[model samples]
Target chain A: MSPMPTESAIAEKRQQILQGAMEIFLHQGYEGTSMDRVATAAGVSKITIYKHFADKEGLFTALIEQIAEQRFNRVLGGIYLEKEPEEVLRHIATQILQLIASDEQYVAFFRLIMGESGRFPELAQLFVRALPQRAWKVLGNYFATHPKLDIANPEATARIFTGTVISYAITQYILHGEQIAPMPSDVLIENLVHLIVNQSSS
Target chain B: MSPMPTESAIAEKRQQILQGAMEIFLHQGYEGTSMDRVATAAGVSKITIYKHFADKEGLFTALIEQIAEQRFNRVLGGIYLEKEPEEVLRHIATQILQLIASDEQYVAFFRLIMGESGRFPELAQLFVRALPQRAWKVLGNYFATHPKLDIANPEATARIFTGTVISYAITQYILHGEQIAPMPSDVLIENLVHLIVNQSSS
Candidate 1:
């Protein structure tokens, strides 16, 4: 929109391009997406799109990082890691479970990334590093440092915590397990926190 | 291979075709696989393939069921349901985790099914019914019937047990989380069982 690309303006354009890319990628999947199509969707020329991203893979990687960071920030951003384990763990479990359950595009994007992972392993790697891995550090650190919890393997415990929630999502959404393995989301969340609370106390 | 289609021979042919289908489908994916490719791979005519399976979807569905059933039967079949909770549960966890980890095609098939879920929701439905749902019932019923465990909610607990294991696999294999959130397979398995055993006893 502006002739002179200020830093903020360039950042804004990049956001616009990523947004358009998400729409196309989700609708068409990774294999089906094209840079030309992205340019048209973003209201920019192909050259302009390339000016921002190195190539198709680079653009997709950026999109993956952006989405993962956004979700990570929203869910993991507010937690006081210093709080008691039950409450803090519960906050994270609730945030991730509900956040993933509600976001269909996010789920679809996940399927897309996973579906394409065989051909595009690096993309999957980008996602792992961006979201799940980052969440691990924050949660892992909390478990390690907290006096009350006193976990032996903070990393493993953290994985167990998020793993239950993520697998619940995988079964419920990814595998379409609601009709089959139908447990209320709250039941899972309650029991998850309960297990940790019980473990630490004993 | 046989001149006349004996009952045994027809079944044998079906197995051969499915083997070929799995190879083609995994490599080419559901969207890219064509009947002609399947016919060539199977060493059968398209008509012969059609006689065995009604359509491409039918063939893929059958393949999904076959893979899930084989794994299920292998893991759940030999386990003596009458065994104690810790031993039985540990057996199930080890079998499922090791079975999945060793089988790249199974993971790849899972990725294919999930990746194509948006476009072909029916395929996903088939998988849930075939694998996760079936596993849920077996484990859920065990939790319900077992007098020792005295689980508050058998279904929820079952989900937690399997969910943690599955999410473990998803991170390590599907999302390539080994580099990011690394942990040994035995560590995850041992801890998961320990958590359950502790909960039930308490």
Candidate 2:
């Protein structure tokens, strides 16, 4: 008996649905999740879910996009583009690790995406397109601005820099393996920073 | 009708079962997999799988142990306890990446384990205990041998090195997304080698 949701209200409701969907998807995976489950979790009716998202896949795509957008904004938010190259790269890696480790939703989202990636290849694509692509682009821009770093391949360097940080996080948390090698995150970052920031190390 | 198999033959057969199980487990996941599927993939009778492993968990455990043993042996195999520390460390990272990237079985094994890790928390422990533990031990031994690097905390350093390589692989293959960060594997190796080989800017 109430009035229909306004445009802003509808958008807000959609966000609420996505947040709930991410929680359930992270915990239960795409296959095991149901519209009823999402409805119950979001405290919305099943029809509302359908109204926002045509189906579960639609909901998932929206969630991934939202997470990707949030991560991109957070990492890109604090950059002092004109800072010293060494400190700049270090900050970027730190930001990346912090994102990977501190964000519970990010970790769970990563796990869910990775877990079902074989089945849902699109999810992986969305992540790369949304998050890593932006990261590499940002680093590439930084490198381009500071040609003095003598980094011949800024794009390649960006990938390696990002790769090293990601590798550290995955090994520590997901792999949870005993020290495959001894470089702690700080030491690793320090050494890596030294290697990349300098001009002639290659 | 055939000649009686020797003890080594029986052992070989057991290894074959484990290998097949690892593949199927990696592809199908724990919940999606069945003993019959493993047997079919292995080209062995159902009884052979049971003979070698008591159940699915037993097969998974045995697979983990086997992979751990192989990884440790490969990483530590040619490492001279007497070699210069920097050279040895770089060699280890380079070798580790080559192994992870090329070995189809390892890739499949990792994908399976990572995807299904949430359902089986014990799987995480098994992986860490088996692989990372031995890796840390090897790095520690290497550090103890080299007095030059003067690293106070070899354990942390080792973790970082391990994490970097894993991140590299995950981004390249597992996270496979569009506009992929394009860095030839050799470039990555060169960058890592640069980081580990030089302790000081001097």
Candidate 3:
């Protein structure tokens, strides 16, 4: 049985479902989870889940989109083009690593998204549409403003930089687990900053 | 409906099943696939597969071990530790990117292993036991001798450096589907070398 819902109440219920869904999705992955489990986890009726999201696919897509938007907005929002180039990039790199290390939900989310991306490719497309292209555009624009960088290829450089930070997190947390060697965040940021900043200046 | 295996032939049959299993596993993932599919793909009897591997778990474990050994050995083997540190690291990076980009079976194997790693944590452990630790030990030793370099944290730095490259390939090929980035491989290597070595020197 399902209760009739008002729009705002429905929205609140939807948010609750997404939060629970994120937890289960991150833990069990997409194929491993079910709508019934999500409904139970959310404390909402299964019919309520259906009413909010047409099916499991819809629910999953909505959940990914919602989080993607939040993540995109959060990370990208903090990245200011107006700042000095080196500082802005260092801030972005530090921001990325800090968020990956601290946010349990985010890491789980990334793991879930990556784990299932091969099976349900639209989830990947949703991520790509949300994040990378936008980051590239911002980065390219930033490099465009900095004629002194001597970077012949801003986009490629950005990929290299992006790859470096991401690979670090994956190795430390996901692949290597607790046995990984400890380096302070500042050391990483310092080394990375040195790599990106022009050395001729100093 | 199984033929008697000759003493010497069991090894050949096992090799055949393992080869076919990689393709099927890569395409369908762990749960979505079946032993029947693998047997059929291998052109071997179901009984033959069982005689060798007993069950899906056993078969998968063997397959993972085989692939991991091949992958880690093939990529890491080419880089001579005896070479200068900069040359060795650059060559290693290029080899890794090429492996991630071109080797579909390896990529598929990695994705499948990582995807199911949570449920079958032994697989993740297998990866750590096989690759990153050995790599760290080798790289750490290399960095220790390179006194002129300003590497404050050798092992952490290596992991970060490796992660960055892997993440780039995953984003470009597996996730985003950029078959080839605009830059040539050597040019890409040059740029990476610039960031890693030249930047540090200055």
Give the best candidate by TM-score: 1
- Chain A TM value for model 2: 0.88
- What tier of docking accuracy does candidate 2 attain? acceptable
Chain B only, TM-score of each candidate: 0.83, 0.77, 0.85
lDDT of 1: 0.80
Name the candidate that leads on DockQ.
Answer: 1
lDDT tens per residue, model 2, A1-202: 9887698988889888887787787777676678888888988899989888877788887887788777777877777767778887778777777777777666667677677666666777777777777878888888867856777667766776776677666556665542432345667787667756754654
> Where does the lowest 10-residue lDDT sum fall in candidate 3 chain B?
B176-185
**Candidate 3 residue lDDT tens string, A64-101:** 88888899887778667666767877889888888888
DockQ of each: 0.58, 0.34, 0.39
Residue B156 error for model 1, in Å?
1.1
Residue pairs in candidate 3 whose N, alpha carbon or C atoms collide under 3 angstroms? A163-B164, A164-B164, A167-B163
lDDT of 2 at B71: 64
Instruction: Output the lDDT of residue B23, model 3.
Output: 77
Please write out the lDDT profile of model 1 over residues B1-202, one tens digit for every residue: 7576579998999999998899888866777678899889989898988899989888988987788677667656776777778888878888888877898887888788878888777768777777777777888898888888767777877888888888888778877767766788878777777677677334
**Runs in model 1 lying further than 4 Å from the true structure:** A1-14, A34-36, A45-55, A200-202, B1-14, B32-39, B44-58, B200-202
Judge candidate 2 against the unseen true structure and give its global Cα lDDT, from 0 to 1.
Answer: 0.70
- Which candidate comes out best when scored by lDDT? 1
What are the lDDT figures for the candidates, one per model? Answer: 0.80, 0.70, 0.73
Reference-based lDDT, residue A29, model 3: 77
